[model samples]
Target: MPSLVPPVLPGGALSGREQPTLYADGALTLRPFRPADAPAVALAFTDPAIQRWHTHAMASADEAVAWINQWRVHWAAERAASWAVTDADDALVGRVGLREINLFDGVAEVAYWVLPEARGRGVVVRATEALARWSFEELGLHRLTLRHSTLNQPSCRAAEKAGFALEGVERSALLHTDGWHDMHLHARLTDLA
Candidate 1:
């Protein structure tokens, strides 16, 4: 086993099975999202559940390509990275991202969503753990934050399953299409990760 991300800190427990650019457990793979993921990502984002739960913006096919291109730009800039989640058969089922990355400080926010067909399969949980383990072990992040719209119970459950503790709620702080809503805050330190 080796470091999954970068700057593998001294004494970190990195797995030799995980590659520097990506990591996988069982059928799930977490790797840098490429332009090839656009089609699958587009289809998943258009899912109504994803729209209602995650507020995915309406986008045309070309827009999806543009969005994916931005992900690549970020990857090149070392500001952030997105990973496409796949199943045992290597079918794209979801996406996860580590956004607002501050590598020098070892902090990041985890974001993820699974397609309708992928939900209830624990895909998000597995993807999250893979990324978190990389952040804690390879990147040496001290903490990770997860925020879920108060209305999203499933996300809250997923956060808990990923070892996050509810810190509190940001009351009516999140502006939505309908109105303002609370956002539940979840945090986990590297030690817990």
Candidate 2:
């Protein structure tokens, strides 16, 4: 009989890094989403900016809970890592995560969004920077990429501020409610030189 257990990484998990309970830097903290955050999560999706980019309008708290639950599955499967961005008061401010993670290739895509009230407060930028650093220093990722609609200037700025250089634009890369949209790609390498 063949063994069913898969090999684990140095941390005894497939992710190859310790999943810390919290990541904080002064005013911002990144922690796993909890069930209590459902109302906030549902409300966030109602914002015009979130709707325009995310394209998923969460209609109820139940839907938000389901989404939150899925994040745990993603983390366990080593497919992605998501964190709830919180402020000094522990209020949910935004979210940041690594998606499309290809551990074998040491590459992952970073994604984030700030709640309407959190916009212009540098929450996204700070969270992204912290996550990128963790990806490189802790997860041993060689590269991290971020992509956003070419029309999302704030996203572009966040990526830039996190040290991700603009790579190029892909036309019609994603289909949204308004039809195909061009995407701007940016990337950062563990070794800048």
Candidate 3:
């Protein structure tokens, strides 16, 4: 029920006021994730596509609650943060997060996934782009990175369309459900800044 717009600030992007909550190609409001979002998160993770690409088991309702709760702890430490991406109707369609923040290097790894219902509609692309821009500009981060198993074409495409250039492939980088395989690393720098 709370507003998603940022607080007042004076500067370039944040100049004189808020950077738009929305950005990129579609519903780009990457706002803070709330505890109340647990139900939707639980539902989204339950989807087959999400579970497959994530290479993990589904989360129970309580696990989803703890996951959402950690967003606050991560935010407080400036180590990482997560946001719920919503449609104009304010239904949560996905989530994106900046994880493993390295302040000494001013970098963070970004991750995201769209619910099956939201895929192919540019939801993840918009959310990721918004999060990347915020990371480089608002958070003063120098770099943001993302990774996906090469077998996941949709995720790789979303990353590319969101302005992340494919960096390289790490062969046998992870043990996915399909098997140990390469991971495509992608990134967007602070060049716009």
Candidate 4:
């Protein structure tokens, strides 16, 4: 007798979501992950730094392919948007994405990583800034958050450099292979003006 779905959202099937092909900010570009990136993804995930912070290690390119498929699934569901970060030469350097999206609340979480060869070059900072700006303006998100273990000083620095101000620390926020780690929460809000 009644349809209770919100007018702003589709009721039956979720469709009409735009999947971006490329997002560029000057020298950096964000594109969807490709199968060709599996080997690179495998190599990057094997890095001790990536494993320590991200807590997921890929032993082979097959696992990397699976991971990429999972990201595709998430995108199809409108649950997350993942991207491959690249340099001007189109070489894969890192990754940045908006995860945990809440359209109704206009909130999302930002996550990123940089390959070992790309470290110390501000890859993540630039990529994240571009992604956050796109999320705020194009996606109509009001706020974006970045969370990283307090032990990850590099990540903390990148978050700050990307304009995400530290909000607070979440005690024992994440459980890594080592143990529970405190997480620093950082956020950026859209300017309504």
Write one digit per residue (lDDT tens) for candidate 4, span 58-171: 989999999998887887776788899988888899999988876656777999999999999888888888887777666677889999999999899888988999999999
The 10-residue segment with the lowest total lDDT in model 3 = 7-16
TM-scores across all candidates? 0.84, 0.90, 0.83, 0.90
In the range 48-156, model 1's lDDT, one tens digit per residue, is 8787767766476677778887876675555666787887676888888878776555677889999888889888888888888888877678889988898999999
TM-score ranking, high to low:
2, 4, 1, 3
lDDT of 3 by residue, 113-192 (tens): 88877777888877888888777876677888899889889889998988889999999998876789899999888994
Worst 10 residues of 4 by lDDT: 6-15
- Please list the residue runs of candidate 1 whose C-alpha ends up more than 4 Å from where it truly belongs after superposition: 1-21
The TM-score obtained by model 4 is: 0.90
Q: How accurate is candidate 4 locally (lDDT)?
A: 0.83
What is the lDDT of every predicted structure here? 0.77, 0.84, 0.76, 0.83
Winner on TM-score (1 vs 4)? 4
Alpha-carbon deviation at 16 in model 4, angstroms: 1.9
- Give stretches of model 4 more than 4 Å off: 1-15, 22-26
Residue pairs that clash (backbone atoms under 3 angstroms), model 4 = none
